[model samples]
Target chain A: MITDRIAVDIKVPNQTRYLCLIGHIGENIARTLRNYSGDREKLAYDLNLVLTEAMANAIQHANEGDPDKEVHIEISIISQRLIIRVFDFGEGFDFKQYVRPGHPLDEHGRGIYLMHSIMDEISYQQTESGHVLKMIKDL
Target chain B: MNLQIEDKGAAVLMAVQEERLDAHNSGELKNHMLKLFEEGKNNLVVDLQAVRFVDSSGLGALVSGFKNASSRNGNLKLSGLQLQVKSMFELTRLHRVFEIYTDSDEALASFQQ
Candidate 1:
């Protein structure tokens, strides 16, 4: 029997103190795959940077600055792909479609645009649970 | 996050040595930058040669700091960004937002009229 699937789930209390946990997640998972195969290190680095940015956006903006809400993350490594799902119990914005040209004069509204630029596939959906962002990349 | 400031008459350089600038340290950086403005130190240069990554919140903090400086007759600049950290600006198109230089010396020299 070959085991090729892994999942990491966490429920953040929607506070700044908990934000640091997000930065370590992708790296930790990637570290665990040292002997597995493929460019696990690069995948982990990418996941770490992109996921932290996405989660930071959720914690800061999507919740309307609410710190009592719930933030959930689901990270799974299956076959040659890594899947990341970040959801929040707050109003969501349409970020995947936002585009700001490489202008050196604008400062805000670039998080989602960058996320899509880095992720291989990104999507969003609204549910009773609030707004969910699903992102996938091949490692 | 740690900051060291140097005032050069026409420009003030802020050297930042932080690994991650997400929500964890974004607020602190914001407060510090604001304090610089309070002291009338306006020519701001953020040294990110050590920061490997930055998130939206971190970027937001930088943006907020720049606005504050701009409102006070000063400017904010960036220096020594790694490829990873530099990409944040490219991805978000924020490379257009800051006066980015390769280092503090370069950024300081540019203040010449």
Candidate 2:
């Protein structure tokens, strides 16, 4: 029989002010998982950077800075992998339709791309309530 | 984020005095840069030595500043990027967009040559 492995779960109001809090949480998670992964500093830095992009999208785009909305985050460790999920309760965009900003001067579109570059795997799923962004890193 | 501005003969150097640049304060940096452009100072050097971390929003602020400076025939260059901050720039492919230097002196000197 296989059992689910749950690590950390948190929900915060959809406010840009909470971004730093998310960063701290991500750093802590990375540090905790470093014991398993044996890459403390790099993993912590990567997670910190990825969380900023993910939470920014949720706070700015998905929830549209609506204070009443909530952003859910879940972290799990399983099978030598660390998984993170960010859930937003708002209309979600199609990730497959995304295109890298053609021009180097483009300012606003690099968040998702940055997320993909650092994480081992990334995918998106639309939930009944809103959407879920799943990211995995090898431990 | 706090910014310290210094007038160095050829270019104005704006040093980011914060340790982290994120959504909470990126807008402040953007607005400050735009304000400098409005004041008729064009050649800009942003010193990021103290900024250890930057997210997409922070990068966006810098891009906006670059565009604003370019619109007025001015230039915006970057210097003193920490390892993680430099990695963020490369990951976003923004390294192609801005001229980055290892130190503020080199970045400031580029404006002359």
Candidate 3:
């Protein structure tokens, strides 16, 4: 069993094409956790889903699909919890105003909802460079 | 955006050939489904047996297709969802919105009924 914190930082161009690569990285990281007692496959899938959604929000919504911009992602495991932070250069939205769409037919709002549902904690904050969306999950 | 499209007389079956459906190719899917609607083939069955992962963008594309089909007085159904993909639908409560089947055949038959 590993007790020390493990972390990785990645910076990718703000393009949708990189979402798959980041998602796979997150999945592989979850699969390698030595102390987690829950289902590894399920945890891996959830991590992949949250990371992909977070990156999509940054690339599409925050960065507005600007290929020139870049998104920063940091994943760390500490104290039996997984932490993920995604940073973008665009203006952040009002997290408090976010509401799950009442209609299931609405197509554009599920990304934030999915991240919140899968992660144990989620927050968006402004940084000196830009904005960062932080998410955590208990292992 | 690899899809195996088969016209089944009553409805069209579009089997996604990709393992993961995310932001990368979901736009292509949305455009293809929109084109099918424009071509007067509004009833569709999307088989996801080959897809193991789907993110919110992929779900959005399917929702967009469903809305377009509904607006045209047609329908869009789904079939062969893997476990993780199925869980995503349930999490977003989209499973209640779209008619799902165990296989493409069943989804096609639903169009007949």
In order, the TM-score of chain B in each prediction is: 0.93, 0.96, 0.99
lDDT of 2 by residue, A4-48 (tens): 355888898888888888887778776665345366766777888
- For candidate 2, give the lDDT: 0.84
Model 1 C-alpha lDDT per residue in residues B1-113, reported as the tens digit of each score = 68777777788777777778876788899998888888878778888888877877788888888888888887888999987778777766678878899987898888865
The digit string of per-residue lDDT tens for model 1 on A1-139 reads 4645888899988776766677678877777763456666555556777777677767776787687787899988787577899998788876744544433444556666666767898887787968888889776
- Candidate 1: give the clashing pairs: A103-B96, A104-B96, A104-B97, A105-B96
Candidate 2 stretches greater than 4 Å from native: A1-6, A34-39, A99-101
| CA error at residue A118 for candidate 2, angstroms | 1.6
Q: What C-alpha lDDT, on a 0 to 100 scale, does residue A1 get in candidate 1?
A: 40
Best by lDDT: 3
> Which portions of model 1 miss their true places by more than 4 Å?
A1-4, A31-42, A96-104, B67-73
**Where does candidate 3 chain B have its weakest 10-residue lDDT segment?**
B55-64
Worst 10 residues of 3 chain A by lDDT: A94-103
Residue A115 miss distance in model 2 (angstroms):
1.0
Show the colliding residue pairs in model 3: none
Candidate 1 chain A, poorest ten consecutive residues by summed lDDT: A99-108
Question: Global lDDT of each model?
Answer: 0.77, 0.84, 0.90
- Give the candidate number with the greatest TM-score: 3
State which candidate has the highest DockQ: 3
